[model samples]
Target: MITIYDWFGYELPIKERYQLIKKVGFDGVLLWWSEGFGRNYYRDAPQIVREAGLFIENIHTPVQNQNHLWLDNLDGESLTDCYLQCVADCAEFEIPTMVVHLPSEDNPYNTLGLNRIKRIAEKAEQLGINVAFENLRNLANLAYVLKQVDSLRIGFCYDCGHHYHYYPDDDLLSMYGSRLMALHLHDIGGSYSQHQLPFDGPINWAAAMKKIAEKNYSGATAIEAMNWDYKHLSAEKFLQEAFERAKRLEALRLYNP
Candidate 1:
């Protein structure tokens, strides 16, 4: 069944974070595929999450200054190599999906990006994992890359906050509706991609939620939001609010498609 998940970070330690997320009524946790501190601390992630009685929805690949993947000046190893390692790590952890972001708007959609996605798609196919490319400021380029790859292993990850902030006039879900594999559910206001809790921002939740239901999306209804905006609220209070909001959003899944 499609379920809601929360983003799990190393903020409050692994076990504690997972327990907190589970207690907040999240069905699962989305993990970041990090090799932090050079010790491969994430090697034990699966076990920790499992012990916390929470399932992992997917893993997010590294994206720090990742435009080099589509740049021509990369001498040898580039950020794409790290992302590939992330894919391998997800396969090893038995995670079914991984979310990826492309270079920022500074980089154009070119052959290099296409080839890299081709390679990643091949690797994902070999390992039986799905690679869902996210939309940032380069929706057209992403559409181009997706069309070029033309493989089942590759799909789209729609981020509501990003769409609200970057391409309010564009219908991203309609563009890649059939290829939808994942979601980064959040809310945003006029300009910044706030990643705020839904209904707190100005996005048209009714229309967006209707679109999601219309697509008949049965994958993870993952909330990619944070409580940083509500620093004054206690951790327990914030989580309770988040859980309530998630429940409201999940109810939208029942809308007639």
Candidate 2:
């Protein structure tokens, strides 16, 4: 079945957040590993999510400001170590996927960086976790790294808003297709990542959903949209509308198999 998941940021308390997500009709919640590690909030998150009766869709890893993981000449080793620990936590929580990112800017790939990815992929395979590389501004470089690694444990996480803003001309859904292990679904305005609800902005929601269905993507469609400018509506009202919108989008996966 196609799963509808929402992202869990450090917005509300863990219990409240997971409760709200469950009430909002999400099948699961995607945890942000960065916030958990940053605030040293590793222990309670999983228990709260489980008690709230929500499945952990995936855990998102950290992103760097400059010289991202797929690049070299920086302190990426520390980041890798953090991610490894995060993967171990995911294993303990029984989470199947972990979303990661490459660099956000144009940069040359480093051999050391590629080796680092390979090692991570190998570890994930051993631990039975899938590592999903998120699409950012540096699609070409990311493509190069994916080609080099070519590991089944390492797949793609297509972020709709990022693709619409950064690689506007590229048909990522078609390019990555079945290799997609996860999705960060959000809408965007012109040249900016609004992270708005699906169809609330300029993205062609129908066409994108059609592509996903055609590709037979069966992973969770996690909503990564945040409260950017929906302040006019009350939080409860906004969440209700978001759930309805997500349901409408979920309908596109009806025939997907």
Q: Which candidate achieves the best lDDT against the true structure?
A: 1
**Per-residue lDDT of model 1, residues 159-213, tens digit only:** 9999988988999998898899898888895234567888899887778888988
Q: Write the per-residue lDDT of candidate 2 for residues 19-123, one digit (tens) a residue.
A: 877786777777766653354674567788888888888887766433556544456777777678867878988989988877655666778878888888889
Question: What's each prediction's TM-score?
Answer: 0.91, 0.89
Q: Residue 175 CA error for candidate 2 (Å)?
A: 1.5
Give each prediction's root-mean-square deviation over alpha carbons: 2.5, 2.7
Off by over 4 Å in 2: 1-11, 36-39, 70-74, 190-192, 255-257
Q: What clash pairs does model 1 have?
A: none
Report the C-alpha displacement of residue 62, candidate 1, in angstroms.
0.6
Clashes of each: 0, 0
lDDT of 2 at 149: 86
- Candidate 2 RMSD computed on C-alpha atoms after optimal superposition onto the true structure: 2.7
